[model samples]
Structures are given as structure tokens and as C-alpha cells.
Target: MQRYFVAPAQISGHTAVLEGDDARHLAQVMRARPGDKFIVCDGSGREALAKVVTVDKDIVRAEIVEERFAESEMAWRVTVAQSLPKGDKLETVIQKGTEAGAAVFLPFLSQRTVVQYDERKEAKRVERWRRIAKEAAEQSHRGVVPEVMAVSSWKSLIGRFAEYDLVLLCYEEEGRAGNGLRRVLTEFAAKQAEGGKPRILIVVGPEGGFDEREAEAAAAAGAKPIGLGKRILRTETAALYALACIAYASGELGGD
Candidate 1:
């Protein structure tokens, strides 16, 4: 069934109201009418099977049929702190990362980051990234949409280290040294086995990658330096790669 996410307020009692783009998509693109059924999520992890009762150009109202759980989310909450890469690479990361079960995306500015920060366009850019995340979440049948946070400075990013249970710094130097992500994640899994769901932050640098000082600063902030493998990955590829491995390790990918 097609899935759509709406604000919690949009769902009341046994009714769901889908407005804006979703409404148009259903009314025009899907050619949905009364009795058409679909899944609707409240963006807060709550979802229900709904049957459309009415449809208009600006809105679509549906009656909730049954509340259901997809269990499509990962066991671990993974946040990707990605340095702003050039062009629309961040869009790719947000889209694919959401599908891979990333819980959040943090675009930060590293020392080697070449893209100039434009304060005037920051809000718009962040909004676009969030839209990408939402669409990807819906298409991937995710329980909740991944958050795309506003861009932050390197210092600001490091300061939030305490917010996560584990912070993995994707450093090529560590990759060359042969220390791998699997080993680090395995140790972390064992350590947190008895605890509740753990939150993980994977920090990936920009095109030029993190300089020695930036890597050292991240490590000092309790972020463990881990390698993706011997092979180097681009800035955009690192976060997605890390998310996939984490998902597979946590059994979200059907591993034993």
C-alpha cells in the first residue's frame, strides 16, 4: 500500500486528513477516490490503515481502518553528521540514508569543507533536505521520517557528542591503519547489550576529508575513530556505507 506521512494533528479519533502535496498526489497522481485504501503515518511513528472517504484538490480525508506496526525501523538510532559536500550530494545522502534507516542527518562545516556557507539560503536548503528525507521515508515504508538538521560548524557538531551513546568518526587514516567499523560496532553492541536502544552518530568529512586537527578534536570529544575499510570513500558515500553496515549489524538487514 502507498504510504503518506502527516502531522499528528491531522489525525483525530478515527479520521486522517492529508493536505498539501500529499492531497494533490492522491487526487491527481494516484487518481484515488472514496474507498481507496492506503497507509498513513503521523510522522511520530504512529501509523494506521486508512480508507479514503473524500478527496479534493487541496485535501483528502480518510477513515482509519486498523492501527498497524511496520517494524521497519532499525534497532539502533543512527545519525549521520555529514560535512557539507559540493553540489546536491547532501540530497543523495539524505534520500538514501533515510532508506537505510538513518534516524537523523546533521550537515556540518569542517575545516576542509569547500562549499561556502550562505546564511541567506540556509533555511531553504535545510527545508529541501527535510523534504527529501520525508519522501524517502514514505517510499521506504519507514515508521518515522528522518530529521535533517540545519548545518552546523565543526565546533558545534563536536559539542553535541554527549547526545549520542556512540560516535564513530569516519577517518581514512583509521582505514589505512586497518581498524574497521565492524570491530568497533561489535564492541559497542556487546557493551550496550543490556541497555535500551543505543543512539549512534557517524561523522563523515567533506571532499578534502578531515584534517588531522579536526579528527583529533572529534576523537577528544568521545568520538571513536573507525574505518569503513582499506578503500577510501567519497564524502557522500561514507555516511550511507556506515549506515548500511550498522543496520546489517543490528539485525535491521535480516542478519543473525
Candidate 2:
């Protein structure tokens, strides 16, 4: 079924009005008509089966047939604090990271970061990244569209460590420990079992990796520096790897 996101105001009392871009896509792109059925999500995990009532040039009206809660969000919230990579790499991160069940994305600057974000174009860049996240979320059948936050400074990144129940920082300086992630995560969960669900923060550095001083500062601020194995990964790959490992260990992969 074709799926699109609808604004909260666009839907009311079993009726949904998809206008502007969605309207154009339905009329000109999908060529939908009255009685045609598709799925629409409100971007906050609410979804409905809607049937087209009218398809005008700039507005597409559909009556919602059914409404239910979406089940595609992760069992545990995982935030990825990724260092800004050069070129269009951040787009790839948001796209794939959303598919992997990340709850939020934070782009941060590190000592090794070389590409500078031009303030004049920051709005446009952030808009593009959010759009990529929306499309990826829809395609992945996700209930929620992961938020893409503005770029942060190194201090700001570390300062937010207290927000999560567990914080893991990928450090190349550490020796390879067998099954380190799984063991640490398991232990953390057991210790915090009395509390509510875990809110995890996984931080990955830029291409040149984290400076020793930065890693030390992060450790001091409640983040545990862990190794992603002996082999080195690119800045982009590190975030994906950590997210995948977390999902598998948490049984989000459907294993018993």
C-alpha cells in the first residue's frame, strides 16, 4: 500500500486532507482517484486506512477508514551522536540509521571534523536531512520519524550525557574485548532493571577518530568508552554498527 505522512490538522473526525506535496503526489504522481485506498501516518505513530473522496489539483481529501497505533518504533530509545562527516555522508547516516530503529540523531563537531557547515545554508541542509529521515521512516514502516537535530559543539555533545540511562562511546584506543558491547549492555540492563526502560546514547567520532583528551572528558561525564573491535570503521559505519548491535542484543531482531 502507498504510504504518506499527514499533518495533525489535515486529519479530523475520520477525514483527512492531504494538500500541497502530498496532493500533487496523489493526483499527478500516483494518479489516485475516489475510492482508492492507502495508508497515512500522522508522524507521531498514529495511522489510518484512508479512502480517497476527492482528488483536486492542490488538495486530496480522503476519509479515514480505520485508525490504530503503529508498532514499528523501537522497544528502547537509542540516540546516535555522530560526528559531522564530509560530503553527503550525513544523509546516508540519517537514512540508514532511521531504518535501524534509532530514536534520534545528533550531529556534532569534533577535533578531526574538517567540513564546516555554512550558517547561511544550515536551514536548507537541516531541511534536506529531515526530508530524508521522513522518507526512510515511511519506507521502513516506522511509526515515528526520528528527529534530526541541529549540529552541536563538542562541549554541548558531552554535556548531554546525563540525559541517558546508559552512554557508550566508541574509542579506538581501547584494546579489542571479546563480546564487549553485548556484555556491557547486558550488565547495564540488569543493574537498571528496577528503573524504567533504558535510554541509550551511542556516540561515534569523525573520520580522524576522537582525540585522547575528548575521550577522557566524555568518560568523566558518565560515558563509558568501549571498543568496536580491533578493525577500524569509518565515521559513518561506526554509528550503524553500534545501532545494529544494540537491536540484535535487545531482541528487536525477533530472536528469543
What RMSD, rounded to one decimal, does every model reach? 1.1, 1.7
Candidate 1, residues 151-187, lDDT tens digits: the string is 9989999999999999999999999999899998887
The numbered model that scores best in lDDT is: 1
The TM-score leader among the candidates is: 1
Model 2, span 1-256: residue lDDT tens:
8888877877799898888887898889899989999889888999999999999999989999999989887767999999899999889999999999998999989999888768798889989999999889888988888999998999999889999988999987763554357677777756655435589999999889999999999999999888887788888888899888888767678966
Error of 1 at 151 (Å): 0.7
Off by over 4 Å in 2: 175-179, 192-196
Quote each prediction's TM-score.
Answer: 0.97, 0.94
What is residue 128's positional error in candidate 1, in angstroms? 0.5
In the predicted model 2, the residue pairs found to clash are none
